[model samples]
Target: MVSSVLQWSIFMSIFSSICCLRRDYFITAEEHWWDYAPSKQNLITNDRTISDRLIQTTEYRIGSVYKKVKLKQFTDGSFRREIKPAPWMGYVGPTIKGETGDVLYVHFRNLASRPYGLHPHGVQYFKDSEGSLYMDGTSGRDKLDDTVPPGYTYTYRWSMLNTFAPTKDDENCVPVGYHPHVRSTKDIDTGVVGILLICKPGTLNPDNSRKDVDREFVLYADTVNETNSWLIDQSLNLCLNPQRCRQLFNQKNEAFITDTLMYSINGYIYGNLPDFPVYEGEKVAFYAMGLNLGLHVFGVQGQSFTFKRKRTHAVVFGIAWFQGLYMTTRNPGRWMIFCKVNYHFNRELYYRLSGMNTHCYSYCYNN
Candidate 1:
């Protein structure tokens, strides 16, 4: 009996270990041309008349220019050569998914013209995987992973430690971000950022789809400085007028830069964002991350969501931060999800709501 029990115990231990095995993801940082605003007709309008006559147009010429930048992404493993859509529409990197107690093996390849590295937030890693160049106690190869030069590759192993798991009051899935740490500000501004989703055990399927929610949306709010467009060769050539690039850059035109600064959601400005689809009763999770400077307040008109049983209409003061919201698709209609800041609201930071039926079942308050 003792020998039989020992064999069973060992078998159970092996099965548990297999169940806790980590997952691997291969991501590459490649430069790609991205059209920041794809809409031919701008949705922004000014009611003021010019000399008592109406002067209306649908184009914000400078803000709608295209640019090339490095983005972190994964390929679909296709054998035939085909043009792939920018990963996550070129706004952010593909969502890296894992669960509590799982390990994430990210093999990063830098295919851009300059050096960049992947640094993750809210994960466990040794000095070699930290992805930032600095004088730490470590020496030798430990510093090599910090800055991945162009044409090089680095593998970073990060463990989703239990400490970052969801608490009792928190949602089943937690959100984290990964971005280039080499020349942090410049790299981030040049479009090297992505999302990481760490879920509770059993909350995510083996394919990384969330079992608890019917749909998920990741929204990144950022202010893109168009003045930096000249830094990339493709953007300079794609300028509305090639000579305009020289004029803007050589003259150090501040007014033109300020006017062209785009307040964008997911690399889309104005009403260029696609409509989010959802069923009437399904659960929806909205994950938001604010990038760069300035205070950003996100609000959804004609709808309200509950956080901790407190009704809130908007994500207030979500400046250079990350937050998530879970809401039932109760009140569905053509709602407006927009930034409430005066500058952003009046500019091009709004998206239309569609494919939702109106059904208000819970109490909600307005902002």
Candidate 2:
């Protein structure tokens, strides 16, 4: 029998190289100070009264602190150990997991001050790990990952091929995003970005998690545009009248760029995102990305989800794209997830989806 079919193809190629794996992360590209209202109070108007229009600081509204440049993660590669995410993951990044035949190895490093790198989108890499730049001609070390200045270091190396798996009708896990393509919209408006996922075969857990999900969130949605921040001139010196924020930023006016553009998520706003526990029946998921800078509609207020296969209650995307919503929590209590448009639902995000509602709310609750 052809020697037992070549010994069962060498025992399924040594059991697919002992159940594939690689994973390493250790990212970086720092720079601090964020605070999109760290309870500088206003849980839907519990109010701290600076005439709370969602934490107003006036003079030209630089209100919610700034000066970003994120993409941190590090727990190794001696980038000192830091893994603290969850203040509703604002300033994004961190969450680069894998599984589809696994293999990642990021290891970036650029301690921020300018130049950046680390691309990612799905998987499989080439062109020296394409970290985005134009002229793909291939010179020197294949263009040192496009641009990784400031106290440098770079690695990239992705792999997850099986055509990047997941599609028996999808959903065994599958996200996609990563940023700082050097000048990619000023390095994602100076906040870098992240979220990768992957998964499938046997559906993870050797600590890759998701043995069928039990709470996971990522909700991106952007439009942060803090005037193309690179610390927009040191955040116009934390404005309170940095010459009327350089005269309404040289009159970019549209009501002062609609009170300093920030209709966010994973970057907080209004409700100041921070409160996530979710109990009742569990299962949960919620990946839902964006950044093509247009529509949003993502929703939730008590429950009803499944998206893409449709059981919907809201899932309209845009902001580059990527979606995966799923729910199982059978109504808990303090809900609210948000972005149903209507001016994104409230603190005036450029008002008028028939009179704004600006909701950046986030609250899952259990305690």
Candidate 3:
């Protein structure tokens, strides 16, 4: 019952923050090419999964690079200078931070070719601030917030309500995801999503950084169905056999479509995420978010973390479920962090995988 209440459960923490403040974030939806396997080689299984037929520039595959629409942050309304995200954040947008009673001002811009809007769950907003389009009995200017046209900017004001805030038993902070609702599922597949952290009083520094945590890692896992991407046509055009790729797409070929799925953690595949160092004994927190289809069992290779007073090495959740895991760095050396769902752990990035096995793409891995 407790698990079901928290839509996508956020993890454990410690606290500080006193005053209610207004936090503003300037965000833009931009189009660019994202390389899942940046190294062009599998790093998790030591490249054992690398096969000529399975990845990159082959007679059929376009490799790991794909055109995507990502939510990028800028300094302000001008949308000129871009704000860099954490090294390990991968493709996710900058984390928005605040305390209970604080108000959030999200200045969203649609710089991409298509229209987009910012819709967040677990927050309080009015009709004009609501970024999702629906028959809410609203019209004219009120509906503009539903989908900001390309080259337009919309401001969504969301309040961190006590009702939606972390429970008293919840350690320090809580997390929720914010993404576009213009096309909902299709928008997420296009790669525009970010995290929102709401904390108790005094839990965060003035800069919004956590006070007690020495290391923080936010990992979002999902099987990106390239078929749903708005850039699908563009991707097909870049394929080795454009006509064949288009045929597969038009026919809705299950085998060919499934082959384009990318099992990723922060938009990276096969242990290719950027390095985020954690020293021994440092207080570390791992926030894992799982989406789309398939159940995920997130496991830490060596150490165990505490969740809801339970000490375990893994946390399980499926679509629309998320977990907050925190652990001190104890076991040394490099370890692996991947979705422990049987074949997903083994055959996910195992390139030579043939046949019409659609389940193969439903799994993802990283180290």
- How many Å off is the CA of 198 in candidate 2? 6.9
Candidate 1: clashing pairs of residues: 270-348
- Pitting candidate 2 against candidate 3, the one with the higher lDDT is 3
| Candidate 2 Cα outliers beyond 4 Å, as residue runs | 1-41, 50-54, 64-97, 103-116, 119-127, 130-139, 148-157, 160-189, 198-201, 204-211, 219-242, 246-265, 270-279, 285-331, 335-367
Quick one: best TM-score, which candidate?
3
Using TM-score, rank the candidates from best to worst. 3, 1, 2
For residue 276, give model 2's deviation from the true position in Å: 7.3
- Winning model by lDDT: 3
Question: What are the models' TM-scores?
Answer: 0.81, 0.37, 0.87
Clashes of 2: 11
Q: After superposition, how far is residue 259 of candidate 2 from its true place, in Å?
A: 14
Off by over 4 Å in 3: 1-19, 46-54, 348-367
Q: What is the lDDT of residue 44 in candidate 1?
A: 53
lDDT of 1 by residue, 1-367 (tens): 3443465466446445644556766677666766555654455544222101111212222435555465544543321232343322346777788888777788787778888898898887767778986667666667778889887878887877677777877788878778877766667767788778878889987667899888788888888665554244455555457577557656777754565566777777666666666667777787777766567877777667765446788776454576677777666665678888886777667876553555332222110
lDDT of 3 at 316: 80
